[model samples]
Target: MNLSGVFYLGWRYLVRNRIKTLLLVAAFSLVWLLPSGLALVVSKIESQLRVRAAGTPLLLGQAGSPLELVFNGLYFTKPGIATFSFGETEAIDESGLATVIPLYARFSVGGGGGGKYRIIGTTLDYFDFRGLELREGRGLIDLGECVVGSKFADANGIGPGDAIISSPETLFDLAGVYPLKMHVVGVLSPSGSPDDQAIFVDLKTTWIIEGLGHGHEDAEKLGNDARLPVSAEDRAAAGETGGEIRLNASVVQFNEVTDENADDFHFHGELSDYPVMAAIVVPTDAKGQAILKGRYGRPGGLQLVAPSEEMDELFATVFSVQDLVLGLLGATGVGTLAIGALVFLLSNRLRRAEFRHLLHLGAAPGAVRALILFEACFVVLSSLVLSVVGLLAIDRFAPVLVRSFFG
Candidate 1:
């Protein structure tokens, strides 16, 4: 018989038992989706992580845990860790082995429409180093002005000229730490990294939040002006004003920094000793990285670590878990295939009378066998197509699905 004739007969048999064909296809498709879908998700996470790690040549921090520091630096997940100082970055920069960028990520805020996002404090080099481009408006140039990530901006309906308020780290603090309002200056283009979920600001901006820096109208200038009420704590923060203390309480401490008052923002003591959670080090060469690593690889808390190596270590554990799951899945797949085979065999046995009648009616035995083979091939091929299509769909949609559910 011609190929088309054989296909027609096989298709007729499948359609005659359409319910059985549908069940078998559904079963096998699910079997294929589980393992393949999980693998695709893991691979997507690993690829994104490696890309972030590869961009930073090395990290220097007062690292009690290397993994914690690396993840906090790259993924912006862990923030309540020991902090070094800007002095470290200055030291590395002076060493001439690499260019160091300080990162201070200790707080988060509620953006427009109540979407939560992290507030990252770093220099303009952070944008250039990360290769982030502005999708709208301009980059952060002044303290208290922030450039939001595309994901955050889109999710919260934030655009240039909108504002976000920092969420207080604690509800109760005797210190005069108040929630500051930050003006959104720009929206960053999506980069498919953790940065896409963060708000970038000048390093001084976070210091202002931390009370280490402040900019306000001179309390001294507000002499004898019966203005807004000023508390004692606000008065103390206002500094020495040699006159009748009738300063505007709002001007006593800067809750917001603007271009007009940017110069007024000053840090007490040496900036070199200012707290920085970590420093991203980009060395000129492999030798420079090795040398810096050797210099800071001390027995004390301070240490230098390679982010890519730390990421590898992290995924080693992930791969172990993946392997165990895949092993169990493989066993389950085998059991399922064996059951499917048994069902096929029993089904064939039940059709023996039909085959015998075909043989009796001048149909050759070989022709009956060929028909059986064709039916079996048709079932297997249909199942295979269903499995492949399901896998492709899962692979394509897995990242977006995961982001929607988890992120």
Candidate 2:
């Protein structure tokens, strides 16, 4: 019996029933691919999350879910997490045990395609802590000036000197949170982190966007048309000994902060009372970290957590679910392989008459057996190749998918 001839005969048979062959290959490929692909994606997400979490020593925020605080501080996610007064950051800073970098990431800027990127209000210390470098221009300096991340700048075609407007909290926002146009002063180098997908601005600029600060024409300069009627009782309540002028809705409030009106922008209340979503706490040493943690150990309105520990707890639960899913997939894969084997057995039975015809033509029984074995090998090898290819594709694209999903 010619081995080459047997392989040729098997190949021709598979080609003649190409639909069945393709279906079997596809089913087998999926059986091998699903579990492996899932594990690859989960591992990628875990590494990414753990690396970022490990870099930050401690995260301080209002008492809430530790996972939510970690996500907000590290990834600029969970924007709706409870916020604490900026004075909390001040207290942490005054402790001298650690350096506190405040973060206010509640607002977002919308892209033309309807996607939104976080607006991270932070200080120059944040750049140093993250080791971020500017790819183009400079860092945040003045009011309404911003520095965009490389990914954001590339996706939106933004660069130094370009401007972006904050998206209003809602279409019908009655809270007076108007969109503020901000000038892009620089673009950050690609860091392959969440920072690469954010827009960084001065903390005060975000407050302006929040309606806590504003700039407008001087009330004293406004004409009678822009002045609200003030009754004698109102004037007495204001402690006005003489004529007093009050500006009304007709007075124009500056939406964009320019050098001309920058000085006019002011907050209505104390800066210490301003809201901060979270703070990244960096200790001088291990001892300092322990001391700081111990100080916040007691129950209070604020909580300090070690991000790495929080991540460990999160992945503990995640791994349990992952194991359960893998078990189900393993069972499914076994069932699929059994069905594939059954198909081959029934196909061989269906080709019994053809095998007999081959024997009459002087082909040995061993040659017929070899032909059947060759076909089975081809299907299994083809499916294995497809599964390997699918895993590689998952490895390549899983990070992107995970980042987008988490963000």
Candidate 3:
């Protein structure tokens, strides 16, 4: 085959009808980018969910539905009952069964416009158990401090000392809402999981912000036993008269009180009356977990959950169908590309005369055949290049796409 003749015919074919070439590039690029981009997003979401679920053992919440608690607590995607008492958690640990870690999630991060960011309420052990590292200062230590995930920090322009606000009770609803501001005590290193888009704070703070940790609006009146609507001074006086003065529900948490009154004060509520969302248990041993599960089944305030089992079932049902549809769309794309190939094959028929003329001008049949092959090669290669370039641009501007569709 003559290389010079091939180049000449390829150049002629490309230059003769620029519009036709551009249309071919545009059509193939669309087909390439659509499937590729969807595949990219699906892969990302699946990978992120798996990463987030790796270390967790079980999630215990209300008995209404297992899937709701799993989604709400783990993925932060479902809304359901939000109270599992501290007493219930204690029973699991005391029953010589599972080592429980409580999860009481009831908030969201500030709006950076990508759905509601996950705001998880947990203990210090959560960071350790989940294998998360501190990015800047330190993890949540005091009640009011919070930690932001890397994506949360980067997207919202947050850092140490920056303020993170608790979004409303409703994820998408914003009516009669009072903002609760939490200070950024630390930033967490990115784990490429949902944590990167989550806000972590002490469980106490989560309850406190939502008026759940302790109920009454006024802390001054919290210590009072009079549920009959008495003020602080009256309650304090009543405490003196009421003898033995059991702690009121409103006043579960107190600080800086004297050591003498410490037992009677500061976090002094019957564990049963206190509200909780859910408990995450890490079983001390397999035998212990089995015994613990039997005990937990009877508790009124809590229910034990197997996070992994429920998650797998839910995702399998939902994503399996999604995978099927995506597979069909991908197949359709292949068929369309097949048709594009057929179109190119037929288009070559029009150039047969030209190739014959080249062959007549002392050109070998192999040279003319190579020129035809090069022209076809140009169509496929140019379309693929354009497609790659467009998808890369989409990846680079992903934040914009997220905001437009989800925010």
Candidate 4:
């Protein structure tokens, strides 16, 4: 029996039955792609999340879901269930064991193409802590001024000297909720994390948006003896007593913070009482983390957790999902094999006349069997190659796909 002759005959038969060959290739490729592709994608997502979590030592937030806190702190995706007092930051700073960085991520800015990026209210220390460099202009030097990330700037075609107006959190009460325009002073270098998708501004900027801070003319300066031209309703609305001072239509909200009115931006209450979404705590040493955890681990209003540990907890759930997906894929693969076998047996039956003619021509039975086996081998080899190529393509696009799905 000439092995090359048998292989050639097998290849020629498959080519003649092109539709069946294509179907078999697709089925078998799916059998390989499902399980392998799933594992590859999960691993990529887990690796990316873990890498981001690794840089963040600990997340401190109001007592709530640990997953939500970690995701919000690391990814800037989750809206905090509750907010912790800025006093917590003061206390942590005074502790001397850890440095706490406050995060306020409550607003979003929608650019062209309906792409909305989170507006992160933090401080200059956040840049220093993350080792972020200004790619274009200066850092955020004043309130209501922002430093955009490289990806965000590129996506929006925005650069230094441009402005970003925050989207209104709600549209029903237009008067109460005003859109703030922030000055774009700089763009950050690519950091390969959620930070690259954010617009960073001073925490005071968020406070102003929240109605916790404002700028206005002193009502005391406008005495009762002075004749006021404004109506009583307008005066009362803009008055500093039972309502917000800057309320009426004439009370123009400072859309952009600049040198002219930056001094006028003042908080209504003590800075310590202001809210922060979460705190990123970096302990001085191993002992410091242990100590900080022990201090805050008690039943309390706030919780402190290591992001890496929270991620491990998350992966446990992910593994359970992976197992379920693999089980389904395994069942599907078994069905594919059964269908493949049926197709093979049916093809042989259909070609019985051809086989009978070959046999009458003095072709050996063993040679016929070798031809069948070679065809099966070819199908398996082709499927393997196609699956490998498909998996590689998926891996190459995994980052963008994951960001689109999760972010």
Clash totals for all models, in order? Answer: 0, 0, 3, 0
The 10-residue segment of model 3 with minimum total lDDT is 254-263
Arrange candidates, best lDDT first. Answer: 2, 4, 1, 3
**Best-matching candidate per TM-score:** 2
Which parts of model 2 have CA positions greater than 4 angstroms off? 111-115, 238-245
lDDT of 2 by residue, 1-407 (tens): 89989988999999999999999999999999999999999899999899989999999999988889999999987888999999988987897888999999989899421237989999899999999999999888799999999989999999998999998767887776688999999999998899888999999999998989999987777778998888888789889975667777777678999989998888998999999999999998899989888888888778999999999999999999999999999999999999999999999999999999999999999999999999999999999999999999999999888777653
Predicted structure with the largest lDDT when compared to the true one: 2
Could you estimate the TM-score for every candidate? Answer: 0.81, 0.96, 0.70, 0.89
lDDT (Cα, 0-100) at 322 in candidate 3: 75
In model 1, pairs of residues that clash are none
Weakest lDDT window of 10 consecutive positions for candidate 4:
240-249
Question: Which pairs of residues collide in candidate 2?
Answer: none
lDDT of 3 by residue, 1-407 (tens): 66986798688778987887787777777778777777666554554455555567777787777777766666666534667677777777686667767776666765522236766777787788778998897876666678988878888889997776675665553332344567787999977556677888877676555554322234444444534454567767766543333444434333212233323322335545666677778888888778767866784645677776765776788678778877887888788789878877787787788777877888888787777678777877887898898778767666444433322
User: In lDDT terms, how accurate is model 4?
Assistant: 0.84
Give the C-alpha miss distance for residue 388 in model 4, angstroms. Answer: 0.5
Off by over 4 Å in 4: 2-8, 111-115, 217-249, 405-407
Residues 1-407 of candidate 1 have per-residue lDDT tens digits of 35565567667888999988787767766677678878888997777678778888888889599999997788777778899888879988998899888998888876321336778999988899989999999987777899999999988899999998887777775677777789998999998777788988888788888888776666566545536655677766877453435644445676777667767777889988889998899997889888987888878968999889998999999999999999899899878878877878898899899878876877666676777788777667777788788778877887676554333
Give the root-mean-square deviation of each candidate in angstroms. Answer: 4.8, 1.9, 6.8, 3.9
